[model samples]
Target: MERTTDPVDETPLTAEEYEAVHAAVAAAAGSRSRSLNSLFADWKDVVEDVEEGYSLCAPEFDDDLACRDALGRAWPLLPPRVRAIRRPELDELDGRFRAATVPWPGRPEEPHQWWRYRIPLVVEAEAGLPRPGGWPLGWEVLPFPKPAGVRVVEWGRP
Candidate 1:
């Protein structure tokens, strides 16, 4: 399900590396009572949204709601390392994004709407992280474990 404008720059991971990453990510997910498979699965559609340049998700329910809900629900469950890496930048960008967005600018009065643009990499990607490795050049090696050689990165990317 992963798609990128360019191929990964580094040498590809071997099967052992792949298992290690999966185990690490799974461990991290288990620590937080989440499922490794489920979180990335949620991201599947969110990534589609980024690729399609469609970010005007409604607060109400729809076909998109499942992925949206999953992402939101999975936020706290994400590894602390992952959140720490993405949060600060996403917070700042979200502020600017909420202000500059066209009609989709969410209402500040409604607290829930205020957070509509807080999606981490997706916001930055739409804001033009360039199109190459910008997805990760946003330096986003998501849902990964420690910054070891093994990272539960975009396994879906081929």
Candidate 2:
């Protein structure tokens, strides 16, 4: 996705929506932010880190989950000003990478983009974070196929 000039949604909120959101935010205790600071040390403290991680993971799901999970958690916390400036850099860079597979001639299953399969959405949508629209959403987990000639390794078997 090409980064826009402004990352935050600029559409104005209705008066009722604005009041309700303001009240909810105002009531939220500072304790929650403090606790996140104390416990979530890996939460990106610098905007540069979030931008860097976003660029890295955009290419494809990394060999492991660390980059994906990190992005999922830190993305919501990023400030709009930073995203406005840094997100555009992506247009110059490669488009977000997608790892996809095609259906076989006889395989009943449809083509699958086995991306973001196990990553956690630690920050839920209510937090107002902008999640990637293309994430593999509905299926919680995909059934992995055994490779040709590679038998399933059972626990405790040599």
Candidate 3:
């Protein structure tokens, strides 16, 4: 008798399975942005010591332009202790301008390139400030994979 491995019961995935696969692909592609931020944060404490604040201008998609503008508008509203740090020299330095093209599908081809600038601010001592939680739309938490591609991950906090 010939022995053969049970054909692994290969079957077409159902609708739910298809959706899951789709989500996983999208998450993988979007994870890069979050990964970059996490890497930067790891070194943030040291950077913060050198300057009161630091900022990064990460190019944003056109859809996110509103969020970027919102941040810019909010900057001036911050207290004096919280200053918007601008380094014209560092502007356009990261080269994160390209629109997302893979892993996630159906995204606009003409997504505007917006900049993500981060500035450090002192959390005011005053007790009366809106609680820090829940960012606006377009802000999402996604898993970041290891650089070596040796592992997989699930939805993660940003």
On lDDT, the candidate that comes out on top is 1
Q: TM-score for every candidate vs. truth?
A: 0.28, 0.26, 0.19
**Deviation in Å, model 2, residue 114 alpha carbon:** 8.1
Against the correct fold, how does model 3 do in TM-score? 0.19
Q: Is candidate 2 or candidate 3 better by lDDT?
A: 2
Residues 1-158 of candidate 3 have per-residue lDDT tens digits of 11223342234335664444334323433432332223223223323421331122112223334333333343344332222122221132222221111222223333232232221121111223222222112222212211221111112234
Best by TM-score: 1
- Model 1 lDDT, full chain set: 0.40
Model 2 stretches with alpha carbons more than 4 Å out: 1-63, 89-96, 99-114, 118-142, 146-158
**Clash numbers, per candidate:** 1, 2, 4
1 or 2, which is superior by lDDT? 1
Pairs that collide, model 1: 136-139
* Runs of candidate 3 exceeding 4 Å displacement: 1-60, 84-158
